[model samples]
Target: MEPPEIRFQILYYLYNKYYGGQTGKLHSAEKIIQETELKNIDRNLINGDIAYLYSSDLVTGKRSIGNGGYPPSIIITNKGIDLVENIINEIIVNILNQQDNRIVKNKIELIAKSDQRTRITKIWGYVKEKPELFVNIGEKALKLFLSGGY
Candidate 1:
């Protein structure tokens, strides 16, 4: 299996490719194989990478039927979309140094590196005082955070 970073890369790739994680869009395994940076990676490894993303709830797809098989379709979940958008937003914040965007890009980088559970825990701790931050954590948690929906 590839490293956790590879899973993230695959997740980000699918998010961008599939209209920023719009639900219900499905693509063949071949398209993913031929188009992404992971193209050169062994098919089995890519399968594993996708599996990792699936387990993390960053993607939704069928499991490969047998050992070392590729899943038939791939779709980035809303959670995955939120992750990528959050990172992008954080970068924009860093570049503009705007007063409203309180988070620095470095924190976003760290959040990107961490798993979903860990990211939520850290963010929760950081903003525990602000009860509004908890509103979207149920359905579109990360999205609310990035959009300042709270």
Candidate 2:
């Protein structure tokens, strides 16, 4: 199975392409490749990603490959939204797992660099003692990170 994070990214991209704007929103395969900041990615690989999500019933799209075919256009399904939510929940669960996850550590480092109260040593010990605080911080950190503030 593709990892949940990768799946979430693909679903998020399609979801945003279909619904992120106030005006008309649609993206072709070429558009997805051209517009996304995802680096070193190949068109064929992304097409395969589309196929995988489509097969999982998480997205709706038509993928055509060959000489005289239209480009792929995809939209997220309701199931995709649910799966994305579940994936985010899983991310929180994983962070709350208290293992040494690199992403959470990195995010904590970012926080430490941003504010003294959120310094890694302080927040780490506090969060270890109080899981609830970690959840609140995690939610905020996740939002900030995804919003490109980190």
Candidate 3:
């Protein structure tokens, strides 16, 4: 298995797109990078993760090779879907069973209130339209929150 945080992010992105009417449609590798915003994680690392996920039969897809392949993409297998759901359910149960889980429960509720796909899509669109704007806005928002604007 991959590192918990990295694995969770990858699975979450796949699950979101899979449920967002994409079905078996392939998602470009570039799109995956953009969606996950894995700046701190090397692209090669994600590629390795993808390869490992594939070897474990959790996912199946294609990769861009040289210049002939043109574009790259990936698609989750049914196994991946099942595994992700199970992992998510287990995580929820674990959190709920934790002592003094009130704060974690609240955070979960906050996340559940939003449509993840829409939020991700908007952010991805912004990145493509103006990456500098996206970075600046995120920094500004975080700064504002730190300054007690939340």
TM-score of each: 0.50, 0.52, 0.60
- What RMSD, rounded to one decimal, does every model reach? 12.3, 11.3, 11.5
Candidate 1, overall lDDT? 0.56
Clashing pairs in 1: 136-141
Error of 2 at 93 (Å): 1.5
lDDT of each: 0.56, 0.52, 0.55
Ranking by lDDT: 1, 3, 2
Report the C-alpha lDDT of model 2 over 15-100, residue by residue, as the tens digit.
55544451234456566656654445655556666666677677765657661333366677777666544434444445555547
- Residue-pair clashes per prediction, in order, are 1, 0, 0
Better of 2 and 3 by lDDT: 3
Error of 3 at 126 (Å): 23
Tens digit of per-residue lDDT, candidate 3, span 1-150: 234445446656887889878888887767777878565687666766666566666667764566232235667778766765554444334434542647546654454444645434444343346444334433433233222222
User: Which stretches in model 2 have alpha-carbon errors above 4 Å?
Assistant: 1-6, 17-19, 22-25, 63-71, 99-150
Q: List the candidate 3 regions with Cα displacement exceeding 4 Å.
A: 63-71, 101-150
Q: For model 3, name the residue pairs that clash.
A: none
